[model samples]
Target: MEPNRTRLIGEYIVGPRIGSGSFAVVWRARHRQLGIEVAVKEIDKKLLSPKVSDNLLKEISILSTISHPNIIRFFEAIETREKIYLVLEYCDGGDLAAYIHKHGKVSEAVARHFMRQLGISIFTFWLFIFDQISSAGLQVLQEKHLIHRDLKPQNLLVSTNEVTPVLKIGDFGFARSLTPQDLADTLCGSPLYMAPEIIQNHKYDAKADLWSVGAILFQLVTGKPPFDGSNQLQLFQNILTSTELRFPPGAIEELHPDCVDLCRCLLRQNPVERITFKEFFNHRFLGELR
Candidate 1:
């Protein structure tokens, strides 16, 4: 069968704009020769500052090197004087946020499926970094571990699948690579999903990402975030002062005990008290899904 062709941007046939952000626009495109569909993120260089430009380069580097089915695949990059094009694996089902908004809360089985994929993707980041440090003979100071500082429903893309929709983590603009023991002080991520440590302006490590995961999981089953307020200040205040994670009264009655336990463990205000990645991956709730 002949390939459907469209307006050519470099070697790709650019189709429709699928997404856009402050300085970039993502388009659905196809390789001219291969005819494979891909998402092309076109970034305007003129809109980027020196620091933001450096972060873009780092994002490119991370995407280029990482390989995981649950993480968005980066094919190649094409750069011109004014714009930079990132060719990526195309996800047809949009993002988790939109899916949740359309479908409302999901069943426990479905939520389990999504959480398992997310957990594995997050674990892969740590495994990839540790491998780089040990196998590449890179010095601890030079070798960096990645933290997807911005992990939320919006950042998770869904690819259509026959049996089950596949989830892939995307948007690494706020991601940072630090030494194994390093802690980040930068305040980043959506206020609702941000860890309390970050809200309090305390140095935090990868445990912060786990808190975001809990927030995502909580929303997946409850149809609303674990905490909420009228503004950012109120939101942060709620996150900081609230001692317990609560599910909606009606939602609580429908949730499994293990699922509730997992959320509570992940949402601990103290990073030290929060469940570790190993524990989270092995939690009974996720274990039962396997």
Candidate 2:
């Protein structure tokens, strides 16, 4: 009744469960002949609702088509009448959220290192240089007209053992292809790092990602988010209009003023006024990029 729980889709044997969400279950798996480790996510056939299965399929389709160092490299996927199988590369370090939670906050040097790694990821994108892993990802996304709706600390995955860090973006489940319908009201993503436009149900685009980056950068510097509240309404209110999230004097003293200035430009309420990917690429904060 539970299907072949002991088996795998092809050569990968389903092992211990790694994580489970409302829509799917992730398991640590191994390839029989290749002897390679992999993460297998299976969509529950019974609970397939709200077209989640379709979403999983779409994610697989896109991931399969695109190849970037920063993007999660898709291993393989299988579909049957009863279920769907997605085999992904295993990241030993896990998500960035776990790392941040373990260590109160990341250091300024480490934050820049992460950004550099992310830049390298977009290197292979259409408009970016292929075979390079240190180019800015935001620039590539802008060229492709794609907006990463969910950009948070947790979504980043680090893969190196160095003190600075080498990172990549993961989890495309909440991603959506921009369309005419997207020009309307629909607010999605975690609240802690959400932008004012998203909080007010206003039309948003790629600029929403800049706001999220600000929140992540804030947490990296202050060890906490810009706003904190026990309830949803209060949190939403703070994110929508509270400008008190500015950097504490003590915190800014530890880093260059340009870093703080860049955060402000990116987090600006008017999406039109927010920092552009090209501008960010040329900002003094990214001195090396310029």
- Scored by lDDT, the top model is 1
Worst 10 residues of 1 by lDDT: 133-142
CA lDDT of each prediction against the hidden true structure = 0.82, 0.71
Steric clash pairs (candidate 1): none
Per-residue C-alpha lDDT of model 2 across residues 1-290, encoded as one tens digit per residue? 28665776688877888778777888889998898988888877788876666666667766776666667678988778877778887777777776678777677777776665554233334543444444455545555555667788777766644455556676776565664235524677789888888888888877787788878777876788877778989888766676544666588788678778877887787888888766766666655542
Identify the runs in model 2 with alpha carbons over 4 angstroms from their true place.
1-6, 119-134, 160-162, 179-184
As a TM-score, model 2 comes out at 0.86
Stretches > 4 Å off in candidate 1: 1-6, 121-144, 161-163, 288-290
Residues 225-285, candidate 1: write the lDDT tens digits.
9999999999999899998887898876899999999899999999999998768767888
Worst 10 residues of 2 by lDDT: 119-128
Candidate 2 residue-wise lDDT at 252: 76
Question: Which candidate has the top score in TM-score?
Answer: 1
